[model samples]
Target: MEWFILFIVGVVGGVIGSLMGLGGGVIVVPALLYLSAYGLIGDISPQLAVGTSLLAVIATGLSSTLAYYKKGNVDIKSGLLFFIGSGPGGVFGSWLNGFLDAETFTLYFGIFIILVSLLLFLQNRLTPVDLPKDNRVMMTYVDAKGIEHQYGYHLPIAVIISFVVGCTSGLFGIGGGALMVPAMLLLFRFPPHIAVATSMFMILLSSTTSSLTHLYLGNIEWILALLLVPGAWFGAKMGAAINTRLKPVTVVLLLRIFLLIFGLRLIIDGLL
Candidate 1:
């Protein structure tokens, strides 16, 4: 039953996270921790859960990035650029993750959840940053409609933000897109489709490094990661298929509420 539960979690997290470009760690982490707390899974620590969730995130990122790339939504160059910062940040965060016990990890994770939940919710609101063009690295993209769009960011600012988000990703076992997407939308002025697709690409790049660090730390649950991979992979494909047919506003709202409650519960558990 526990294994089955985890498989299902992979599917749910992968599908929703693919759409959101978060790589499913937000869902997977909380689910793993909750199951462990309830004895539905055996002796799973926060580090293990995070490591496992990050592994699943890789599967989701790979699946989603491929699908988005074929659709011409992914900004491969930008993704690589951000990875310059995020990759190193992920390694640092992974090293830091090894120092925390269950209680402390849980409390910090709970706070992270709340912050991520709020960020995801706010992303739906379209706010323009309109940065100075001179200070920005401008990008030109031609959408499916053949309409050319201009977007980009200040190099230093983008790198710094990606680094911080990447650190959070490795520390919490996420894809780093929870914060990245919003920053892309609001700060970097990326188009929605472009932001999400590029975020997946960056996640794909960064998660690899982060997972390697986790492996070195022996924080990953290899067996569970294997189980999660298949479901996460397939679910990401499903989500990408739905991208053209759906808008995620309603879904995100519900996700925010669910995460809010779950995050608070984890906080309480940590305090206890």
Candidate 2:
């Protein structure tokens, strides 16, 4: 029964993760924790939950990547550059996780989620439909379709950001796409759809390393992760299909609402 519920959770998480390029942690972590506390997820340790979530992200990333690939939205050149740094960063973050307690991880995760949500909200509110140039950390490349895309931040800066994002993902059992997508769009100047695709591709690298490290350390719960993957794959496809149609401002607003709700939940949980 517990297994069945976890599987259902995975499906729902996967669908959301794929659609939003959030990498599933935003949904999976809180849901798992809440369910576990209620004894709805069976006998699962908090560390196990974290580990399982990381492993599940690997599947989510792959599913999202494949979905984005089908849409021709992924930017391989930039994604390769970002992946180089993030791949190892995942291992480093996972190693660091060994040093922290479950509460510490949860608290930090909650805070980070809240912060991202706020950033998304601000970006939506401040940036007009036809926003001007923002050269904070830009990069540029030509896509397969002959579109010469310009992004913020050079390759080196993106690598540096990837390292930090990877560490957070490893430490907190997240996919880090939530951070990566925004960074790509707002900081790197990639379009939102392109950013989502690229972020998914990069997450494949980080999540793979993180999952492997966790699995080797006996952190992952295979049964749960497996259950989550199928649903996530379908969700990713759905998300990719909708990416172009959805307005960036609307997406940000919705994502912000999700973040606010999740953030408040975490804060309340931490306080209680």
Candidate 3:
């Protein structure tokens, strides 16, 4: 029954997360919390919940990255550059998690969630012309459809942000896609679809590194993570298919709503 519950959560989380470029931790964490409270997973703690969620994010990232890559949305150069910093930061964050309390972790997560929410809201309101693109570091890619796109400038910023987000993911068991997608869109001026696809590529590397580190630190639940992967895989493929048919505004609004709900749920969980 517990595994069944996890499978369902994983599918739903993956679908929503793939659509919005999230790590699915927002959904996974809550599911873990409920199951643990009911003794569904014996003696499971919040830390385990976070760690397991991170591990699941690793799977989701791998699946989504492959799908996006097939569709020609990944920016390999930029993704590799960001991973250089994020990979190490993830290890560091996992190490630090061993010393932190649940309240401390929750507080940090709450603050980040709120900040991400606000940033997305504000960005949506801004006109494209009002948002200036940084052209410092550039990368080019050809999509599956044979469309060529170039992204230039803000390479340094992308690296810096990826490191920060990776650290958080390592610590909190998230994929940091919330921040990554926005960074790609707002900082690098990527189209929403491209931003999401690229974010998946970046998160795959970052989350895998972090998950492996966390697993070594005794934070991962392999059984649970394995159970979730199948559902996540199915959902990701479905979501990727949907991405091609949806309007940008519609996708953004849907993502915003999901984030808001997740943020609110987390906030309530923290307060209680």
Number of the predicted model whose TM-score against the real structure is largest = 1
User: How close to the true structure is residue 111 of candidate 1, measured as C-alpha lDDT?
Assistant: 89
lDDT for model 2: 0.73
Query: lDDT at 235 for candidate 1?
Result: 89
lDDT of 3 by residue, 1-272 (tens): 88888898888777766777877776787677667767987766656877888867766777777888787776777778888778887888878778766656555666666776676778777654323454577667666577777666466666788888888778777688877777777567776777887777777888888888877878877788888888887777767677767755675676567667766766777677
Question: TM-scores for all candidates?
Answer: 0.97, 0.86, 0.86
Candidate 2, pairs of clashing residues:
137-152, 137-153, 138-151, 138-152, 138-153, 139-151, 139-152, 151-188, 152-188, 152-189
State the lDDT at 34 in candidate 1: 81
Clashes of each: 0, 10, 3
lDDT of 2 by residue, 65-184 (tens): 887887677887778888778888888888887776656666766788898788766664444222334434445657666888775556667789898878777877778887777677
lDDT of each residue in 111-229, candidate 1, tens digit only: 88888777766766757777777867899999888989888898888899999878988999888998898999888888888998999899988888998999988889888888888
Ranking of models by lDDT = 1, 3, 2
Stretches > 4 Å off in candidate 1: none
Go through the candidates in order and give each one's C-alpha lDDT. Answer: 0.87, 0.73, 0.74
lDDT of 2 at 260: 89
In model 2, the worst 10-residue window by lDDT is 128-137
Local error of candidate 1 at residue 215 (angstroms): 0.5
Instruction: At residue 252, give the lDDT of candidate 1.
Output: 79
